[model samples]
Target: MTLGEILAVAAVGISALTLWDSHQERVRTEEKAVATADRADAEAAVLVLRATPSRDGDRLTLAPLNPEQAIQAQTILFPSALKLPPVETTGDPRIEADWFAEPLKRARKGAGQKDEDPGDQRLPIIVVTHYLAGGARHTSRAIHDLGYTLEGRFLRGSAVTLRGMSIVRTVKEEGAQAALDAVWTGRHRSAG
Candidate 1:
């Protein structure tokens, strides 16, 4: 073939190579995004502590602080396998409570202790999983609500790609009185 024909063939070959590279890059980007999303679905749990200050009885709720609008998944309440220490209602500010005991609970279930003795009295753990607006089964926050308040740190995820925040601490709950008081009076809490 002539030099011109050779140059034309070279140009076509280069264009084809470039297109293939572009396609590979696109595929890699898509894979990265999917992996990131999967990681996000298994995102860390949030710890929330809520209480109602009232004369009747101060009801406290411990749970994961997820989006308020997020829908709740089927909550599974598995009794603690190992004996979790009772809530120490004491003078000291910090009380000892099990922080995120889901894994422990699962391990216990895996073992045949509970199968042998089902009647055993174990403190039930309320595990509530919340789904984000995207409808992905995001996180399963296990709150072992005792008198002790959770203490830890949660680092928020990046702002560019909004995902679940990593809850370093361990809780969520709503006050019954607060809801009722708002519904009835539509005003502030009555000062005692």
Candidate 2:
């Protein structure tokens, strides 16, 4: 073939390659944007709940931190070391004395005498909440710390209270049932 013809073909080939590369880059950018949006949506649907101790300090009242994202369903799983069964509820559930009294007693008894820090007496539990936002159901898993301190004038008793609650890393789940199953089976690992 003539030199001019060969040069023309080479230019055309280079132009085609440039167009293909641009198309691939656009596709990648679009995909990334969609993934980011999905992640944001998942986070927005997560419910942050707070635990309040009753007057007697034996029962706990659980409620959502945000009133708008009311809890549709809830489940709480104690640490494997506690060997406690999972608690489930469809409404604002009041945790009776039985649900946590024994555990607190055992934990206080188990506390080492050498340790003087009250923080050492805290217990960790996993809380999974399902809520509806924008007509879609979302599930979130969080870790809450239950704090206990020695109280009383002369009897020297311990009072169980909620220290704080924080959402675990990658808290978003595919669905409510799947998240509950993962937590129950110890498959869900919290980042904090």
Candidate 3:
């Protein structure tokens, strides 16, 4: 073949190879992007699942604090759980009221124990869970009404890529109020 014709054929082959390489690279990039999106969706699903009630019949209760001593204390009664431990406040202050003993008290009183006045043993605890990447300023500010003092926090995760933060606060009277307000206001950051 003529030299010019040969050179032209070689150029055409190189062009074809280049096009094939570009197509393969594009396919790879697309696959990577899809995989990343799928992973993100999965991470969100996991967060939602974590927020669901993992313990059924797990009663949640709160103890009434001394309104005078407790800042922002109100007459509103709070619920508590029987099987759970005393109020645990690490990140912020919290109150523990004996919710599990009411039924027992009634039963005992019915059995003729009138002196069984369930003592007001309430310790305040404020728990905040942050899913995904978010700042803690709002939560910190909201719990202020609940009398919570930021004590400590830690991250919880089932995998390395995704995790949630568990903020435990110790609530005094005002801190408890703020925490209750947060709950009432639905201030917790949602995935949506």
Clashing pairs in 2: none
Q: Decide which is better by TM-score, 1 or 2.
A: 2
Best by the TM-score measure: 2
Q: Please identify model 1 stretches exceeding 4 Å from their true place.
A: 44-57, 68-133, 137-145, 148-192
**Tens-digit lDDT track for model 1 on 97-177?**
233243333433455323233222222234444544345445444433232111222473111111111222223345422
| TM-score per model over all chains | 0.40, 0.54, 0.32
lDDT of 3 at 105: 34
**All candidates: CA RMSD (Å):** 18.6, 8.8, 17.2
The whole-model lDDT of each prediction reads: 0.37, 0.61, 0.34
Please tell me which predicted candidate would have the highest lDDT against the true structure: 2
Query: What is the model-wide C-alpha lDDT for candidate 2?
Result: 0.61
- Point out the worst 10-residue segment of candidate 3 by lDDT: 156-165
Model 3 reaches what TM-score against the true structure?
0.32
Residues 1-192, model 3: lDDT tens digits? 999999999999999999999999999999999999787555432221111111321222222122212121212222221123333333323232233234323333344433322432122223432222221111221121122111112562111111111323434445565464344334222200
